[model samples]
Target: MELSSFLLAVIEDLGADLDPPTRYTRYVNALVAALPGNACALLKMEGKALKPLAVHGLTPDSLGRRFELSEHPRLNAIVTYRGVTHFPNKSTLPDPYDGLLEGVHAGDLNVHDCMGCALHVNGKLWGAITLDSLRAGVFDARVERAMAMFARLGEAVVNVAGLSESAAAWRPDTLNVKDLGMLEAVQLARHDMIGDSDAMHTLKREIQTVSRSQLAVLVHGETGVGKELVAQALHAMSDRANLPLVVINCAALPDQLIESELFGHVKGAFSGADNNRQGKFEMANGGTLFLDEVGELSASAQAKLLRVLQSGQVQRVGSDREHQVDVRIVAASNRDLAAEVKAGRFRADLYHRLCVYPLHIPPLRERGDDVVLLAGYFLEQNRSRLGLRNLRLGRGCEAALKHYSWPGNVRELEHTLGRAALKARRDGLGAMVTVELEHLDLLSELPTQACAVINSVNNAARMSMPMGEVSYREAIDGFSKNLIQRVLVETQGNRAAAARQLGLDSGNFHRMLKRLELL
Candidate 1:
């Protein structure tokens, strides 16, 4: 086939409606067939590293390895040089895929002539397409010209894919928003919760039951478990949904400012008070006031809050006048307020007032398969943000996500997926990008206990187990406690370090330690 016809055919295949992995496979297969080489691979540039996107002649493990540009001068030369970089068969620099080629023995390091052309999109260096040949001087002037044309065609295909993805992402049917009644709003709010686990269903039922009442609610959960989302859902379903939902982070304000923040301060109340200011309670009159991290409130502020909850009245700072405010309270805390009350750190009256209708959100680990569902949701959000046609989780990625414990919960999952998608895009996997196991970068985030548990499960599956057994729940609890103990020992009594090593937030880690009697 003519060079132009071959290039056209490659572009057509790239534009075909296929998933990311398949599309990438086809692109590399076509490149090797059209170029004067026995093997070819497409690599995306991520920061200073070159990550393999698709390969025709390399082992699958190559996709898991990231080749740093600074560490590999040969690969660096390919991206740095404008035209094709032809490496001699006897080049001193080691090949990134020296032992990674198909049929290559473990100890054998075969040296092959190689040529690479950097693929650029919108005048920016996006990635590279490289070819390897056993025959010396296979890439002559004609081959170089053909390779350059192919790179240009590849860029055009990527641009088109990006445009197509952007168009599909904002399709009218996907984003159609209409006027919603109170009933419709409640239904929509439930859908926004984003999980199908029994825990989620129970929480939804509780929200529904409480939304119709006037009782104060205390949302209890680990940090990043979407406490604020629960508050929003409660407000959305309540009769006060039309009124403003005032939010305040008790932990974010200083002890001295807590009272002033919750109650209006007179003009001469304190140093910074230049004018009379309405507090959250006043702002949320006849509405809902969401007090996040309410356990962080000081003793004085707790007393004032308890009084207001009981009497529906707020007394402004430095003023004799008392204000009547009918505000529904929705408080959240990662800390156990009941324990805090017993420990004399929190006021008992305040704790009792807030715990009137306590609702506990389940941690991410307890919600099986929900992790994958949430991952898919976050991936689509990212794909839309990055103007990519499709973002898919690779098979191994799905398994890893399901197996790993999410210490940071939904918030962490969202951030992790967003970062992974950006990294994938940076690597030049435009349009349809598949989030592979390597893309997740979850090693640092996996808790020590969780990692051990995952590894142990894998190992145990490979070997025969003892006949003696306990219930699955009991066995899991025992395994978890043991893992925690091991991690605590490794950290040498440093709870914070142990928490990080286990990929858990400090608060959750401390709770786990206490629960396991390791504290």
Candidate 2:
């Protein structure tokens, strides 16, 4: 067949009516089959594996498992060296896929000759197309010429078809855009929280399911995972968005003042109560009140707070009158409320109440490839923020963020990218805005912030935990305790404000703080 005819056929096949998502795969299969042979294959690269995108005349299950490029010396050789290698007889070359080759031979297709070409897009290796025939030595000079033309045409079609990124790691059918940029992903706000890995998807689904309710939610996760964002999302998407989203930091305030801050105090209620002040509850009336580091609330405070949640009423200090407040409570704490309850540090009833709905946000390290999406978002956001339009992450920055365990979660990433963009913009003197990963070096600084936090004793001591391999559940509890203690200090024991800042439910935050014995 003439090269032009083959090109036209392939082009037309791609443009034909098919499922919008799978059209490219269909085109690749059709192009590979047009060769004058019974066995033809088209493969696209995704991560470490070169996936068989389209196949025909080979066997029934030709596209089952992906062909690892590292295992296929011939294919790998072609892909690695950027050249197409052909041999008329199988015996002439070292066969990399020994078992696969034998299976093909058993199928009664004696490869007298074969021709294959590397598919290139953006001048880089994208994948390969191979045609096998039963006629020995049939792939003559003419066949090679035809294969070359097919490869060239295939390159254009592949590029235009938008399959240049390869089909394995980047299956658009599987890649929902919403999941990609989900920094604080949960099903309620957006759905595309993409990670096939068990841990990630589990967290994503849990967040989605838990997001539907107004019940006080307790989010337990590591420091960097976006807990507060989850709380904000809950409030923003819930029936309470139109009202105030009030935040308080239990750890940020003095222990004695917590009750007054949450329930509000009338003038002359206590020392320095010179004027009447509406507390967070009053401020957040008919809205969502987020109590972050909630475990830091004192026992007396917890009892009073529980009554308010249970009764939907609050009595101001120095006032006998109780006011009705319609507020949805969301609480977050980086502490183990159960442990606090056992230790007599937290109220069990409050813990149960706050845990009516729970959301756990995963850290950046567990988001898999979502790191790249978030990095891009941060990079762009920072670029605009710093007034540096050309600033972008270099290859190293991109790869570093992907591999780096973001201990601080989304906030850390945003800060790092913003700082890096600024540094890059300044260093380049406007010559280069593409930032290298010097900022990622900040990853090592995560532990420095994790020193001995004030425990329930309000005394500094390294937190004690069971030593040895632990489960995700255990890790979450420990991290929560550590984070609650730390955020309380950072936010100065103000639960409501801290909850807002950390994107967590204030009530749940209080529960965890209580459980962790912070109260």
Candidate 3:
């Protein structure tokens, strides 16, 4: 394909209505066809990282990975350079996608030729279009010039695709950057909705719609499904975004202290009170107050909470004066509050108040290949933390991850990768670590028929147990040893993480490991 024809095609497609991913992908595909490269990617700059928006000739998991400039020298150079930058065949800088090229084996992971040009949309640095070739000297001077022209078309693609609206929305003066810069703030807001699943798309749209109002929002999701993150997203996109978003876990406090925490108490009102403290409501005045585990509130606590919601006023503990507060409420729960209300455990009125606008987060098992994308995100994070040159999933690992029913959801996926990375490193794989299926340690959740088959086998094995031969103490000791050993392996030999999972004290766990001679 000639560069002129490719540019003309992109210009012609400018008026077509297409999704951002589809549009970005068209640009990447066209660029790869026109240029001399084995792999090409269209990345978007977000905060300090570069996220691949579209890819051709790269692994699917590559879409999930975020390349932080500080960690990826090649990407940093590409984005920092004024125009098209080409790396020599033997450049010392590491390739960010060393082993990510599609159809490439592990033995031939090195990218010999590379060139990229940073993209600018409306005079601001948007991202870059990177191309990599396996054969050396493929990206010569002429190819570099073509890349520069393609970058111009890439910028136009972003503009015509209507993504420039959101990209331009985050003005420096409007955002309150306490510790984050303009780029970081915009990036954080944009990347908050990470997945491309239909359920996730619906949830994102609901969040955007509900954020404009002051109605209380109830976030519903299973444990480890990131209900708190949903609350954060709601507050971040709300009208009161600039104001504080104070969070309080209702289940973390005792029944007696719930009121004191929700409504401020005067000094000496409580036994442990050393000074007059403003409660969560007062602290979040004109902002948002996120109540986590809201269904755990006691009956009396529920009444007090209902009163505040009804009156838009709070009376502190041991005080007669009532103070008015302009605060938006966002509550989250793992349990079904409506079920609790039906059972006469939760107040129906309080439930109604909080459920004015409800948002349900889809579980990991239902989000399809989003599991792999999320894994990619975690892999990059682990790579930086573990000080590795590169970290990626091994062959067939993506399929295994997608098929496993993640009962513990996103948190479990994160810990699983963290442990896998540790295991791969401990095995002396060095800087370039690959997490294989075995490293995942996923026990498939069996179907009913499969369980029946296992049950028959278990019965046969039990018949041969010789139950009286082993003493009760011996049986218990064996069980304990097996459990500890399994946990150690699952945690990748991290004794601290293992102890936490088992709900044991660190000191006690260490002593037990010593007693079992497994340390």
Writing each residue's lDDT as its tens digit, candidate 3 over 100-174 gives 775454556664898899998788899999999988988888898889888888889988765534543365322
Worst 10 residues of 1 by lDDT: 174-183
Native-to-model Cα distance after best TM-score fit, residue 200 in candidate 2, in Å: 6.0
Candidate 1 global CA lDDT score: 0.72
* Candidate achieving higher TM-score, 1 or 2: 1
| lDDT at 484, model 1 | 74
For candidate 1, give the lDDT of residue 488: 75
> Which parts of model 1 are misplaced by more than 4 Å?
1-192, 443-519
Task: Note the Cα lDDT for every prediction shown.
Answer: 0.72, 0.61, 0.78
* Residue range 1-519, candidate 2, lDDT tens digits: 655665777777655544432554555555555556646767776555565555554321234334446545566766665455676676554332221221222223334566578888897788888776666777777667767777776676667556432342255334233332233333223222323334455665555455446667887776656666666766655666577889888779786887788888999998899999898999999888888888888888788889998999988889999999988878888777778899999999999999887776666665544555555445545544665423444323433554455667766776777777777777764323556546456434433222222122112111222232442223445666766666778888888776654434344456556757877
Candidate number that wins on lDDT, 2 or 3: 3
